[model samples]
Target: MKKKSVGIIAEYNPFHNGHLYQIEESVKATGAEVVIAAMSGNFVQRGVPAIADKWQRAEAAVRSGVDIVIEIPTVFACNSAHNFAEAGVEILENLGADFISFGSESGNIEELKGIARVIEENSEYIENFISKKTKDGWSYPRARRAAVESITGASAASLLDSPNNILAIEYIGKISNALPVTIMRTGPGYNEFETTEKFASATAIRSLINENEDISHFMPEEAKNIFLKSEPVDKDVYFRLICHKVLSADSTDMEKAPAGGEGLANKLKASIRMCSNLEELSESLKSKRYTRTRIDRFICQTLLGIDREKKTDNYIRVLGLSSNGREYIREVKKSETCRLPIITNINKDIKNFKGIGYGISVDILAADIYNIAAGKDLYRFSEYLRRPFCE
Candidate 1:
């Protein structure tokens, strides 16, 4: 029996066949007895509510062969890629994972690691290079890629061309200890969507679902069932709510948000006055200094009341786990595998807490907002009332 555990971090926006492939490959590659997943709660790194809630996604992961599934926290889940990777790394480290695996466009784990090392070693030089590039009208990501090319080579910069490849570098860069594994990405590109393809991108799968197309090929049965039944978040309603929040907030309130600062706040207020939807709002505010994804991050942070100096709650919120996962947790608790308090039920420890100082509280707030978007109030689906799903 393999003694080691492997960790995978993902949004699993709706766990699909690609996710299942990663789960099996991670085990085969690492010979890991347990596969622990650090998942985004209600919101994803792309600054949007998950197609299904966190519980549904976690349960899907467990059914698809992940042993233990934990929340990656709202503060990290809905932020930029760097923050997302850093938070995921920290949680897996806490879980005592011996290996980490991720899907990447480049499919070269060693090359990515080499690039990560070069970036880490020349952090100061990179920062200066990025500043120069950005000043000359480049986006932060573009600037960073060019800066890396200046140090390593063109191939190293090419690694950042795709979304998954960018995430791979971040995952490897943040690794202080765990062994890294890379699975070559197959099928359409991360942004490309083809519902007819066997390995459709999650983006395509989501679009197919949105169009009410049968996605049985892309998703597992359990995930497909959940996706079909779960109340999808009403983006229109949520966008209206955000517009109201932006239109009503004064300069002082916007300044306090600190996500976009005073200038971003002004732009947000101006954008909401004209735009009726999230897409329009983003387009209205998009500029040389900010990419669409950057705008989305700022808007999400602003809407969620996240401040500049984000605080961490330092708690492990277990969404769900399988029988093997439970056994694995028991082992971790017996030893020093995980250093943080493992929270299984929010109703007990997290629900009634009046203070917002708890790190998990942010996740709770995000869930409640999702509840609102999902047309639930005082519903059992609230994260507060959720008990760990054990299979």
Candidate 2:
């Protein structure tokens, strides 16, 4: 039998104690010798810039015990939960992982799989059910829950209440090849604002950082050091760019956006004149038909020149890898298991990776936006300028 490696799909927006715990526990639970992570780039699933750049975030994972770190496409990174989870699992599977590991409120893998089964078996009916609820002015998550409850019953549907459980369900639903292992989540839940010494949510850490409060206790020493050197993207500066994009561009041209810029694009443009900040902009544009996350993703696509029209996830980009990580990739390459080429630097390797021209093009473009947003430049933001952090 082939060696068993566990893959983790995460943002690691700032790798904290909780992330470290998940990694340690995953290794113990599955006896997987190698741990590979498919992480988001500059943008995250929430439709916001990551607290730290991809380099720092990826490096943090390496220092904390991840064997290999690969970048998920920016378009998928800044998309909806389903899109994000699908691409993440795809990349990990492509990397030849034997099993995927995740932290969830309900550590029972069977329960999450049960919900996944209900959705997969009744996909057509569930889609119709969600569509009906959406037409009636319910949010996607709300509509999805109603549909899930109909199939899985209210007891199972309640599992979707926690953020990790919802993502765990998505992972279970998306993975086609690898088995999934759920590591019990310890401490506060997702977006939990206050943190104890032993546990703090990524949301709480970012909030604390914004307040200039010390979070040394919550983050790994190495991750915190890298985080301190980098500056977080300012919402006002980027929102200024987003606001202008909404105002100057023809609403008719929004078909490239995720929701087809007709109603939602017009809503953003209509509300553009009154909004003052990113928070207000997101709030004003949110409706039953389009959500805040969808609106934020639209803005991300609009600015980065990404559209639903050309969504091709054809390559896995390496951000950072430890020594064992290098060994793992070599084995995967020799085995010829991954369908898509793995690239270290897009500018240098795009030519080598066939049929991924568009994917690389957007990957480069997104870094440019991230550089401008984070107030970094060619010194740090340029993809070709930095070497892979192989320790």
User: What is candidate 2's lDDT per residue for 42-102, written digit by digit as tens?
Assistant: 8888778899988889898999898899888887777777888998999999988889999
lDDT of each: 0.81, 0.84
Off by over 4 Å in 1: 195-197, 252-259, 350-358
**Root-mean-square deviation of candidate 1:** 2.3
User: Residue 379 in model 1: shift from native, Å?
Assistant: 4.0
Candidate 2 residues lying further than 4 Å off, grouped into runs, are 1-3, 260-262
What TM-score would each prediction reach against the true structure?
A: 0.94, 0.96
- The best candidate by lDDT is 2
